[model samples]
Target chain A: MKAEDVIRFCGRSLAGYPLRTGLMLLAMAIGVAAVVLLTSLGEGARRYVAGKFTSLGTHLLIVLPGRSETVGGPPPLLGQTPRDLTVDDALALTRSSAVRRVAPLMLGSAPVSLESRSREAIIMGTTADMFEVRNLEMAQGRFLPPGEVGRAEAVCVLGQKLRNELFGNGSPLGAFVRIGQRRFRVIGVLTKKGESLGTDLGEVALIPVASASALFNRASLFRILVQAQSREAIPRAKKAILQIIQERHEGEEDVTVITQDALLATFDRIFKALTLAVGGIAAISLAVAGILIMNVMLIAVSQRTGEIGLLMAIGAPGKQIQRLFLSEAAMLSLVGAAVGLLLALAGHWVLARLFPEFPLSVPIWSPITAVGVALATGLIFGVLPARRASRLDPVVALSRR
Target chain B: MIRLESIERIFQVGDERVFALRQVDLAVRSGEYLSIMGPSGSGKSTMLNILGLLDRPDKGVYQLDGRDATHLTDRQQAEMRRHKIGFIFQFFHLIPRLTAAENVELPLTLAGVDPVARKECVAAALARLGLAERAKHRPDQLSGGQRQRVAIARATIMRPALVLADEPTGNLDRASGTEVIHTIESLNAEGMTVVMVTHDPELGRRARRQVRMLDGRIVSDSGAGHEG
Candidate 1:
């Protein structure tokens, strides 16, 4: 028979058993949909984390005072006391040719007042190079001046929200404000950079590192941010920073130098594994769907034995009989896979709308893989039933009522 | 021409081997109307199944139109059946899902006939069987006589050289049975060989020659002179 006629014959048979066909389609659709949606969510999470890290600037490295077992993890607890990283160590790191700029950091909280209004704010102490190293933008005025290392200059920059609270949109350049019993002039107002990596950039107060050390009465630095000259120089910059800091700390590797690429790569590997694991878990359901197809097709074959015998009696070859059953399965899987893709797309759209902050996206290969797997499953599982139908004794089948 | 020599078919019913057909010899010439009559378990249906290649005898040499058909492969046998044989069944065995026209077109379709030729041939066959007006009706919607006419059209659609009817009127009333018998007689009148199996002596007597079977062996043949 012509291919189109065979397809029409199978189509007519399926139409005769609408409820059974609908059930088979539903099972296959759910299988494909599970694979698409689960993998999309996993891929979305990976992109969200990658986006956060990329926001910190390119070819960057962070130097923390204590050592972490891995680049991206928190520092160990209750270990041997590590040598402190100081302002001198930060200054020594800039001598390396691979390093472009460095920002020595100190963190503390203090109350600030302008005239009578007062509010407590997170205080970030860093050098003037922080503006270039961390990609911070200035809305007005200038950043802190490059001066002597221990000169405790009484100048500061304010985040956009902090400036709004302290001066209420009024021009506050050069206006003196009190921070931790020390008065400082506001040199710059930072543009709104939003929240990133748990730090709300719009709400913090920035000051000269020397003044912050005196006000908080501490010489130990929290972290030192370094920028490499180029993408190729990141590893060189990290090695140089470790050597400089280790040499300054009596030849002990007391600090951890984490490159932004290393952190991003670790996160990339973890999320890729997560996506595959979830996809694998969802593929189990597809196998179950395949088994269901087998069961339903077996039942269909037995139920239509008379019809099969009739076709044989009318001179259809055994191969043609098998092809008829297989074509039925292929048709079901194709339609089901199409419906599943549409459902997954609709689900992804709803999720993206519900959570605008997440970078949700379905990878290009997912739909193609889903459709391919569904068709393969249908064909493979359809084998036994089709074989049985083809091997039936025509005389016996015809005699059966 | 048809020939069967020393045909022997056995059925193992648990420990006892029953002989369905034993050392039976028969010959049928072309363009002859013949009937085989027997009681239940007399091997009439078994003989029909073997002749139609639906079953293979344990020991036999059957020839049709001078070709050795006993050992043909499954595919070769199917090809022969597709081109040279047609069957009409007692219950009309029309696929319930298809309309009369589609059922009649089945044999031609399986032979890979083109759509234009298939349509023309199906229309001509249905008209010959007096089913052109009922071509669009499903089997359930047609009366017994009309459904049998549809089956007759399906049987002859491929223009087979030989037609086999197994109790073709067993499920119909007397009037419909007579109508179905007349339809088969008219086809036989066109010089197509007709071999019908029936237990009704009246129906058997309508044929030009008759063969009687007792148990698994043929007891008598009235038309041995017509053998090719």
Candidate 2:
């Protein structure tokens, strides 16, 4: 038959059962909308975390000291090796290559006095280069130079947020602050850099490494932070730095080099499975939609059995009847796809607005997925009805009212 | 030309075997206007269906123009029916969904005739049936006589040589029935073979050849010597 004839047949068949067709479309649309909404949420959360990590500068690489052993569950004590990084190890790695700067951190939490303003702060002793490695901008004055590190310079750079807390919009720079009987001058105020991986970078203070080492007095470095030329050369730069640290530690492999990209990649691997899991579950809804379509079509065929027999008796082929029903199925899915697209856009907009921190991504793939689900659902459900319609015995069918 | 020799049809109803037609033999030559007269349940409709190629006998030799139709495949029989046989029913089975013109055009369309040819042929068929003005009216819009005329037009649209009409006037009023019978007899006079089944003895006597059946067997066959 001609395409136009088939189209006409399909149109009339659908018109014959408006309510049933409408319900089929609604069911399919719901299934598609679920997939789009959930995937967008997952994408949004991933983007939020990735952005937070990147703003802290791509140069900084963290070397977590020991293996946690258990899969993200818990670190086993039996396989727990102590941290072997020392001040000397940090010094050794820092001096090798175009490794422009490095900082050995010794983090401690304490209550301090800043021009009569007292609050709890995370105190860290590190070289001025720690500011550069963390991409910290000085809002007020200068950070400690290399000549000032380990020289007992009673000077530190307070983050923009900490400065606000201590001085209440006043300049805390060029003022004396006390931490455990020691007085330090706040020479600079770090610029506003928000949280990275949930740690508020804007709330910490950095001082000379030697002074922090002596006060908190750790013979071993808590963690050595390194910065490279740019994000592109970070891997080459990290590998060289790792070799330098290995040699300095008498060929020990205790230090871990974790780059931002690698961490983001790991995050992707973790979330990829998550997205597929949700998407796969959404696929189950499609299967359910298919089943619903099939049930509706079967009922429709049974209702029209006499009409079908009449056509057959008048020389219409079994193939034609099957195609007519399948066409009806496709129309339901097509309309459902259109409705699902509109719904997905509204849902995505709401999700993005409600969770600004998580930038939900509604890629073209999301809507396309809706279409695929609809088509698949239509076919899966439509086949059984078509087959049943085609296989109907003409004699019995004609006798049915 | 059509001839049936020893035609037999047996249908199974539960554990009993019912014979619809048995040891039936007859000849219907070209241009013959003949009717098989019988009461209800005497196999008149079954014989008509078999003769129309809509059903087949379990044991028989059916020759249409000297070719054995009994051995032909279902598809082949349908093709032969499409090209050479026309059927008219008592209720005037003009498809309700189609207009008078389109209902007549169905046979030509099924034969893969081009649209231009189909249009011209359909217009001619409707005009000849005196329904040119009502060509676009569906069956429901037409009177009983007009519907039967439309059915006649559709059956003869393919110019089939033989027409098998079962109780062609059974559903019509006497005048409408007379009009329908006249339309069919005129076609037979134009050299088309017509085999009609009717219970009305007055109508049955009008055929040049009258065949009678009782108990699944032909009891008598009488005809004009020159069927043409």
Best by DockQ: 1
TM-score of 1: 0.90
Task: Please give me the total number of clashing residue pairs in predicted model 2.
Answer: 1
Which pairs, if any, clash in model 1? none
TM-score, candidate 2, is: 0.74
Write model 1 residue lDDT over B33-152, tens digit each, in one string.
Answer: 999999999999999998888889999899988998899887887887888888888878888889999999988887788989999998898888888899899999999999988988
State which candidate has the highest lDDT: 1
**Model 1, range A304-397, lDDT digits (tens) per residue?**
8888887888888789899999999898888889888888888989998999888888888777888899999999999999999999998988
